[model samples]
Target chain A: MKIIACYSNKGGVGKTASSANLAHLMAQSGHKVLLCDLDPQGASSFYFRLKPAKKLSEDSFFTDQDKLLKAIKGSDYENLDVLPANMDFRDFDIFLSRLAKGHSALKKALKGVKKDYDIVLLDCPPTISMLSESVFSCANWVLVPVIPSTLSERTLEQLLDFFTQHKLEKSKILAFFSMVQVSKKLHLDTMQRLGEQHADLLLNTYIPFSSHIERMGVNRAPATDFAKATPAAQHYLDLWRELATRI
Target chain B: MPRLWHSQGEGDFTPLLSWLENKAVQRGLVLSQTEFLSGPLALIDNGDCQIAEQGKSLLRLSHKLLSISQRDIYPLHRKDQPPFDFPLPPRELCERIEQPPAWLLGLAPLRNLQILARGKGRYQQWRLTNRLHKTCGIIYLLDIELNGISAQHFCFCQTYRGFTKSEKLLTSWQRYIKDVFPGQTAGVSEIVALYRRHPLVVHHANTSMQKGRPDIASQTKRWLKPLLLAAFSNEQGIILDIDTEYLHQYRVNMRKARSLLSLCKGAFEENQQQHCANQLANWMQNTNVLRDLDVHLQDQVTYQQILPPHLHCQADKLRHNLQKERQIAQQRLSDQLQSTAYQTNKQILMQSIAQLNDGDKGQKPATQYGRKRLIRQLNKIFVLTGQLHDQSPDDELHRLRIALKKARYLAEFFQRPKTTKRLSVLASSLKQLTQDFGLFNDACVQQQALHGWLDSARAIKRPPSENIEALTLLLRYYQEQKRQTKYKISQHLRLLNDPNHQSALLAATQNLI
Candidate 1:
């Protein structure tokens, strides 16, 4: 299973949109995928058309990986699966802390579940709390959709540096541009500069600004599905293509 | 010191001890001896055998020859259960694991009616039993059913077909007694045998013990319906998992007293294992040894490939290229050289390399197992698409994780060669791959949860979004977990691409067929 986390320290960078589209693209490619909406804001769940779970339900047993994996649920797409955020997930840290190996709560939960999916996407809240830390520890890659602004860049750097300075594993972090307004010279230059400076780190595809993307909320459809034929669709298609192959 | 005290006198002493006990009990005499176990049965001490306060009804003596108990054994202390738990029939009942024509000394007619009720209550279950077959003492099943209120007296015969209220039952029951024990004829003519040996054990059911509580009548009719239905099914009692015999008990046990469970580990198919050996498949996936194939897979479908497959999709191209590369590899190694000089000089090196590769000389490239067969087998055990499959990705991710586990187990079993010092380095790469796979597995689980939530909405009969907003907060939380997993899987996979990690990975994952 490949994990891609759409995370940003600051909200409103289209984190949910990016995650939702990537999930769609991954699933479109015949890969069994799971889109986990872990943001308390639940925007990703909304994008996926899932009613946020009121509670964790019985699958909370999944958090304890040492025991047998309790089966779970999925989405409308054939292979796309998701773990919708729940109110109980808010208190997850407490439950996780009570475990024998707290650091591996998510890791343990992930155990014995890979046979069902080819890729898993995580849409994280814009926070640097323990949940984010836990997410970082559990994910295969952290995909930050920077809006190509100096502020977004700073946050991205912090997220990257947090893992790097700790001497944490470096290979799982994949950063790319999201909501890029190419008409803006700054957006164009930043995209170019990011490619030049960290060509290896930046994803070749950048999510471009699309008015239709904002209206995806009104339509209650994922941007990838809503803009299937648009340039924005290509962005997700490219991201999934890149990620599906990499994983 | 002797775990088995009755291993004496060359011949089995079980029958002899049974004979002696029956002789003493016929006249209601208590036999008392203590010198030795079963040599000559020397009389070491004699008494009228007053029952100890603990076990008030039976004799209070110890002998190595017999599996006897102290008189202090309270009637209540002995659990009254379906007799199979005992592993042997009552000495007074005269049944055993090695006897023939056995009978389950039945409950009194009224209790018999309670335990076995309705329709086919006396079907195949009443068949005569050989002494060797297992049967609990003084126990019988009843079939019956009821509605409106929970019936006080329930019968189990509803689920069993082999039960019958036939005369053959009595004859078979008698033959069982006469077979294991020939000295005494179990006094015939009784419709249902009382547990004649024990002194009518009555335990305090909080006060005055409720002995012989089972009443055949005044029971629900529900038991009868199910019992009658089950009796016709013919599979009422035999364990359905016949593969239990082939399964070996692992020294390392988990879960419960029974090491094997129909869930988790047992495969649904008994005949398919040899056809496709995957007992160790999960172990192998955990190890992620096939990571080498990923690069090869990537290269074939790569945009740079000179010859693209007929399909225009990148995925198709990748698949085709991967196949082509494998074919090329096979061809390159297929040609045999004729030179004796080259043969002798390069044979050892080639042989060692071939052994390391387990390379098909020229036949075919080994296929990469893409987590499918394992999933297929598991699905057979429990449908991957059941309501249990969920409306989301949580279960799918979980299934993936299971495969990863099998991979890990496989890798551990086939560790890099210890003889070579590079083995340590190889182990390190294998560890890195493990982390990568672990991250991937997490991502799979996170996604499943989302998909499942949507399904949950339908299951609960609620329209989408009516409760959706309320559920969002929770779903987001799960998504965050998945997002994090993506990072880890990517990071770990990249780590494997590192040149430094490659040699080690190959070393540990070297095919050794």
Candidate 2:
């Protein structure tokens, strides 16, 4: 099984949306997918129409094996399931920091479900901290959604630098332009410049900014499930197909 | 296909649906409904229901497509797609069914009903709580099928992830269903079995063996009747040339019945027995040419294996000639089956058996006769086996093999609960001996057939050297086979002749007396 983290230091880059869509598409293609709502925000869980697992706190999730496994609820789709995020997940960083060999805490927690899923997707919270270290250590690939802006471009560089400093595999970071508006000249130029600068690191497919994606909150389901005909969902399907070939 | 349960009445889904709705409301669940679709379904299985017996699944031919649940769905009506192949995948069901198309059992108009979720954790909880649930994603389906009339059957199907393994849930569901709707629930398989009891619905004769010991005369009649019916039932299939197994089984049952008649003499009136034996011999003799050609054509692969790579074309040519002969033979056999003379003979044979007394006059009780006959046959087989020398000709060994087979067949006829263990051991040994003898006989037959083919070729014209060479290679292969098995045959005979084996065989049969 491969663990993929939809992670970016900056929020609202469509990280959770991308993670939910990828997990949905993978499950649609006959792969068993478990979208771990690592984000305390529970955006992925909301998209899957799953409530936060009852009484499952961050400490119990990591320490109690059954708590984590039992927390995995079946999504509306056939092969996709979700480990819904709880408010208690906000303490994840603090819980990891207290652990021995704290960086590998997430990996140890995910071990119980490793065999049960073909792909374990982490909808990682936006931050660089103890939990991010654990996420990096556990994930086979760190999918960073860039919004095709100067700040997002700078964050990718910072992530690369961080990987180098910590001696992490830089190749694990796969950045793709998300929430892209081709009409904007700044967005176009930044995407073009990044494509040339980081040829191998960036993917060709970009998820366009669409109102249909915003309606995911209203639908309480993934865009692919509720608004499959929309452009945003179509882009995610394309992205998943491309990712399938590489991974 | 999932297991189904039928309610006591029909023409309404309101009661069950309301129960589900109320349960969902009580438990805070969301109930969803799917529009019902109806279609005609052809349920196919081998004559023995082998597919359903294995996985509780059937090959459903509906909407011009043939499919087993969670397996391949091939569009039989589409010309663009490739034809369906035998020995289908998902090893659970399809492999057990041989020649699915030929084994088409029944056709029924089917209605599919799907009851979606009612609550938050109901799907998981239902599966977690229901122990007997092997299906995933439980969809309550109500099927209204035509079995001379429209009959309703409710099916609980599982999709996606199967039910969770919980013993507590299983026991609860068992008691729960029984308490709620006792005597109303029946599994889908049981319903199908009931429908298949109609002669028109299931044309295949019941070929399954009868269990336990009965009077020899009664048992003999029981065995022969089914075997005869099985052969008759397969007659149309053989003529249609659907699959080889039809003719194969026809020949097998005919041979077995003939063997029983020969082995268990005086079970019926002498005149009646003589007439029956004469009729059987003639039928077998008439079908012999077709059966031989069938065996030869079927053994094409083995024949090909015996030849050199260079002689492959000759092997193919030989196969082509054999297939042509088989076609002609099959036509003749079909004609004979359709003939008035053949029909009259079969009808008379079947009718006469009904008139025959249970056992011959002056005969002892069936069990006594069976026990005494078994001991007598066993002694006869041992005597014949003892008489075999190292340099005994093929004919002598063939005679010995026949004796052993008769003794084995007699033992099978008298099998009881008391003698089962000893009979099983003796059967195992008998099986080994027969296999060894079968190989030895194949060698002798192949050599003779090759020589006959050569003589026939010379009669027509000088045969091609490649064909001659391939035939020679096959003959040599069989020669080696015969030589190699000489030692194995002696070893098998040694086991049969062992003092302990003799004692065991005697002890097992002695209790019958």
Query: Which ranges of candidate 1 are over 4 A from the true structure?
Result: A57-72, A93-100, B1-513
Error of 1 at B119 (Å): 51
Q: In angstroms, what RMSD does candidate 2 have relative to the true structure?
A: 10.5
Question: Which tens-of-lDDT digit does each residue in B39-147 have in candidate 2?
Answer: 5544544444444544333423232333332222122233333433322222322233432332232311111111110111001012211211112233444443544
DockQ of 1: 0.01
What C-alpha lDDT values do all the predictions have? 0.42, 0.68
- The candidates' interface RMSDs, in order, read 23.8, 8.3
Poorest lDDT segment (10 consecutive residues) of candidate 2 chain B = B115-124
